[model samples]
Target: MVLSSSLSHLALLVSLSANNVLAAPRPSSPMSLSMNLKRRVPEARSADDISAWAANNKLALEAKYGNTKSIAKRSSGQNLIVNQKADSSFFGSLAVGTPPVAYDVILDTGSADLWLASSDCADSACDGVPTFKASDSSTFQNKSTEFSITYGSGAAAGSLGEDVVQMAGFSVSNQIFGVCDQVTDNLLNSPVSGLLGLAFQTIASSGASPLWQTLASSNAWDQPLMAFQLTRYNNDSKATDLEPGGTFTMGATNTSLYTGDIDYNDIPDNDESYWLQTVSSITSQANSISISSGSSALAAIDTGTTLIGGPADAVAEIYSNIPDAEAGTGQLEGYYIYPCSTTVNVTMAFGGKSWAISNADFQAEQLNSNTCMGAFFSLETGSNAPAWIVGDTFLKNVYSVFRYNPASVGFAQLSSEALAMNGVNGASTPSATIGSAAATVSATAGTRDANSAVALFHSSPSTTGPIISLLAITMTMFISLRLV
Candidate 1:
C-alpha cells in the first residue's frame, strides 16, 4: 500500500547502549571531509527514455497523493552497445552497523531520512543489490516500528532501526534509518542499495533527525555546512557506470573545486526543509529571452533529481522563446521538444547573480535524428510547492554550497578542472540584457575567499574524523525521477 509523508510520524522506540553513543568532536580548527561520487548510467539510452521514465514517475506520485495542483504539498535506460551519452545518476559509499558493512547509496539532498534494503527482504526489487543485515551487527537496534515513503517514481516500506552509520571517515552513533523489506521495481533496477537524504529533519518521513542534522547538531564538524561538486558524463568518451562522478564535501567548502566568490542566497527561515532559494529570473541566453522576472518563485537546489522542473505557465513561457519549439504530446506531455542542433543556453539568477547553464546540459538528450528533449519540464504546482525544482542539469555547472547555521544556498563558478570534465569553456557569465528589458543586476565578475571564518564547534573530541582520498566505484542503474 502507498503511504503519505505524514505516515512517517508513527512512534518508534530505539534502544541504545552507553558504549554505542558517539561523542561530538571539537577540532583545533575547521576542516572539510570529501568523498568521491560514482556515476552510474544505463547502457545506450536517449532523451525519450528519460521523458517516459519521468512521466510514469509523476503518475505514480499523483496516484499516491491527490492531484498536485490542488494538494498544495511541498514535495530510463536500455542496454544497446551504441556510444550513447545521456544524463547519469550518482551514488557514494557509506557503512552502517558494527563491523562496517559498506553500501552504495544515492546521496540525495531532495529528501530526508536514510533507508537500505534489508537482508531478509524477499521482494524481487531487492534482488542483486546489497542489503543491510541487522543480525550481523552487534550494535544494531531494531525499533520494530513500520514506516513507508512514497517517491515520485515509487515507494518503499520497512521497519525503523538505529545503528552506527559511517561516511567520509566520520561516524554518527545510534543513527535512525530504515531497513526496507519491500521496494518498487524502479529502485530495484538501480545499482544503489538505498538512499541517504541530506535535507532538514522537519520533512523527514521517518520523523527522526536526518543523518546530516544529527552530525551537525552534535558538532561533528567545525561548520554546519555541506557542499557538492557533481560531475557529468555526457561528454566522456569512455563513460561507464564507474566514471569519476565528482566530490561530496562536508563541514567546509573545497576552494579548489570552485573559482571566484560564492554568490550566497539566503533561505527564508520559514522554508528550511530543502535548500531553497528565490529565483530572480530565467533567461534564454541565445536570444536573451527572459521569463519570471521580478518573480518570488522559490527554487530548490536538489542533487538527487536529474532534470529541472518548474510551474507549467513559467516553463511554457520559457520554451515559447525558442524557435520552432513545440509542446510534447501524449506520454511526452508537460515537456517541450526542440531541434537537437539548437544551442540552448539558459541562465538562472539568484541574489542578482546569473549563472549560465551549458548548452550540453540544457539539451537533455536527442529524442530523434532531428529533435531533442529539453531538460526543463513543467511540474505540477500547489500553494506550498516550490515554483522551480533545480536539479543536476543546472547544478553541474556551478559549485553549490548548503549552509545550516544561517540557512543559505551559495553558488560559484566552476574551476578549470570541473569545466574540463564537463567539456565546457570558461565560467558562464551573466547576460547583459534579458528579453525586452534591462537586466536587474549589472554584469560584473566577483570573488569571495573560501576560507572566510564562520561558526566553530566547541564540543568534545570524537574518535572518528573528516576529507582526502577519492575512490570511484562502478555500478549500473536506470534513470528515474527521485523528487520527494
Candidate 2:
C-alpha cells in the first residue's frame, strides 16, 4: 500500500502529537484523564454471549420460620393446574344494583395491598364509576375483617370479605378479599369495590396469614405461586378497562407474553408472600438489585410498596447520570435522556451478578430534540427520606411470578405451555419449570442514605395506592406504598 506525501506527513504528526499528550512531563488535566479513563473501562456485557445466556437462563424461590428462615428442605408443591391469560383478558367489575358492572383489575407483584371499586364510597376520588355494594354481589360474604392501608398521598380503609372470583379458567370458591368501606380523596378512579390481596400475608391482623397464603399452604395446586400481568392502560380514562386489560394465572406464563430466559429467587417467607432477599451489601446511596429480567428501579424489585418511593438525591443522581436530564424545578419530575446517536446502557446487579438492559428493552418513545422519554420507575425524593420502589415502570419490563415451594421464595417469568387464557386452556403442553427471584437484594448499583427504609419487604407496586410501611423502626426511614 502506498500513501500520498501529505497524508503520510499528517499521520506522522498525529502520532507524535498523541505521544506528547500521553507522555508529557507533567500530568494532563483531570477532566481529560477522566474521559480517557471512562473509555478504558471494560464493557459491562458481551453482545455475543450475554443475550444468549440471559435468554436461556431467563426461565424464572422460599422460606418459613417467622421473619428469618433456614433452608431445611425443598418444599414439595401443590398440584393445582396453572392457567394464564393476556393482559387484555382477565376482566372484573363493580355491580351496584343491576347485574354487576364489569371492570378490569390490575394484578401487581410490586404491591401487596389489594382494593377495588366499592359501593359505599362517594366522592371526586371515585373515578366516575359505581362503587361496589355488599348487598349487590351474589357472592359477597361478609367476614367482618377490617382493613386499612395508608399512602404517601392518602389512605384506603376497608373490611375483609369473601367474593366469587372468576379467572384462570377456574372459579375460586369463597375467595377471601378486601372490601373497601371508606374512601381516600386522592384515590385515582373510584367505585373501587375491593382489592384482592394476592400476597401470601397481610398486616391487617396480628400474626394472621393472608388468603393467598392460606391457598398456598393448602397446596390447592401442584405449585404454590401465582402469575399475573396488567395491560398498559396508556390513558387518563381507560375505556378499554371496562372491557378487559389484565390477567391472573395459577400455574404458568402465558405464551403470548414476551418470552426470555428466567432467573428465580425464593421468598424469605415460606409462604407465597414476603418476597425478601439478602442485601449482599449496603451503603448510603442506591441498593443493587439482581432483577435479571429487565432494567427497572431498585424500588420496584420490592413487593412491600404501593407507590415508588426513594431518596431525592439518588433520584436526582440517577437522572443526572444520563446526559441532558434537566433538574426538576417546581413541578417537573426529572428523567434520563440521551442523544439519538447515543446508546443508553442501564444495568443492575443482583445475586452477585450484573445484567444489562437488552436492545428490545431499550424501546423508547422519542419526544423532541432527537431525545427519548421513558421511566423504569418514578422514585421521587419523599420529604421523609431515600427509598427505591419498583413500580409499574419497573415490573412491566419483566414478567413477574410468585413461587411457593422448593425454596419458599417468589418466582417470576414462568415457562408453562398449557396456560389458560380468555378463561380457556388455549395451549398444548403443561408447564415444565417455575422461576425464582433473588432473595438477596443488594445496594451495589448506587449509594445509600444515612437513614434508609427498612431492608425487609413483603411486596409492593408502582401505581397510586395505599401505603405500607416496610421500614423497620431500626432503619428509621419511612418507605410507603401508595395505592392506586
Candidate 3:
C-alpha cells in the first residue's frame, strides 16, 4: 500500500578542493547491481481456496478504512479438480549488520521503509522466519524511537535503529530501519523476512530515508534508477516455490531483457509519493468499449501488489464490455467472473502509448466449467485514492524502470526470450473439469468482524513521533489460482 504525504526534496552538496577550486564531478558510468528474484508459489486445489484468498483481500480493504472485520469462512463443497498455480510474491536476499546477516526481503515499490523481524519478536507470524539480532552488529545503533506501520492486511510495531545494509554487492551505511518486536500473522511470512520499499521517503511511515534513497544520496550507483523484469511461470506444474523470477537491477537498465526503445512517462509533480502516472485510457478489444478515459484515470505502478485494481465503477464498466461477465457475490463480492471461453483482450495506455495485457494474465482462476475469475478487482474509492492500481498483471508485460532524479517511470516491450517464457506469443487456453464447481452465486451476504486496529504508541527516549495516519491508500496482497 502507498501512503500520501508532503513531498520532500533531496539536495546533493559538492565539496571544493583545498585550492578553493570546485572539483569536477565523476563521469557517469553504466554500472548496475543486478540479482535474480525468487518466486513463491502456493497451490490452490479448490474453489474454496480461491474464495478464501479473495475474502482475505476484502478484509484487508475494510481494515484500511478503520472498518476491520472478521472474515467469514464460506465453503462451496464443489470439488473443482485443477492444478492452479498461485504465485504470490517475489523476493530476494539482502544482508544487514557488520557480518552481513542475510535475509530474504520483498522488493516493494509501493511503500517506503525497510523493516525486519527482530530476535525478540514473539509473534507467531515471526515463527520459522529469520530475525535480526542487533547485538551481533558492531555498528548497530538503537535510536530508541518507537514506530508502528499499518498495512492493508497486517501491522508491525517496534523501535527504530540504524545499521549497515547490503544488497547485490552495494552497501548502505547508517541506514535507518525498523526492528520489529511485534507483528501480525501477515507481516513476516515464511521465506520472506521483510520488505525493502523502493518508493520515496515522503511516504515512509518511520519518517526516515528509505534504503534506496539513502543509497542514492550516498552516490552508491552509477545512475539514480532501478529496473525490473518480472518472470512468469504460465502454470508450469514442475515449478517450485523458489523458481527463477527474472532480474532486478539498480542504476542502469538491462538491454538484453527488453526490445526497442523504452517509453518514459512523467510522474505528476504533486503526486510523487508513489510512482503514480496518468492513464490515458483503458479499452477492451473484444467488445470495443472504452472502459475508462480522461486525465483523472490515474494509476499507481506498484510491484508489491499481485493484481490490478480499479474504482468500483470503472471495474463494472470494464466487465460491462465483456459478454457474460457476471459480478461475483458472497465470499467474492468485490470480484468478477466471466465465461472461460471469452477472450478478454484488454489494453491500457499511459502517455498515449498502449500496452496489451496477455490473456494468461487477464483471467485469474476457473471457478466452474464456464466461469473464471478476472484479475481486476474493485478497490475503495475516494478523493485520496488513486483511480487504479497497476500491479504484476500489467507489469510483467514490459521492462519497467524507476528513475530518481527526474522521477519518471519507464516501460519497454519484453524481449523475444522473455515473451516466449511468458507464453505471450502462443498462450494456451485454460483447461479445467467444471462439473463439480458451483456455477452460480447468490447475493452478497456475510458477517465480518473488524480486524485489530493499528496500534500507535510512544515510549521513552523516542526520536520520532507516533504515526498519525497512513501515507497513501495501499491495496492488500491478493493470491489466486487458475487452470492454464
Instruction: Output the lDDT of residue 16, model 1.
Output: 6
- lDDT per residue as tens, model 1, 280-380: 77787444433454223777677766567777787887788788899988767877889877777788887668899877777765666688778787765
Model 1: runs farther than 4 Å from truth? 1-42, 45-51, 57-86, 286-296, 423-484
TM-score of each: 0.75, 0.50, 0.74
Query: How well is each residue in 1-484 modelled by candidate 2, as lDDT tens digits?
Result: 0111232222211111111100001112110000000001111222222222111111100000111222111122111111111111122321111222233232333334445546565555565544556676664777786766543333567786665433321223344555665655533322223333344353322123443444444543334565444323222121222222234434333333434444565433333333433222222113332321211222224322211223445444544555565542222233333454445454443343234443222322233446443333233322221134333333333445566554422323422331221122122212111122111111111111223211222111111221111111110001111121
Pairs of residues at least 3 apart in sequence or in different chains that clash in candidate 1: 33-467, 34-467, 261-447, 261-448
All models: lDDT?
Answer: 0.55, 0.31, 0.56
Question: Regarding lDDT, does 1 or 2 come out ahead?
Answer: 1
lDDT of 3 by residue, 259-343 (tens): 8777888887556777887877777754443445543477777776657777788788888888889898887888998988888
TM accuracy, model 1: 0.75
Residue runs of model 3 more than 4 Å from their true location after superposition: 1-41, 59-85, 286-296, 423-484
State in Å the error of residue 61, model 1: 7.4
Worst 10 residues of 3 by lDDT: 9-18
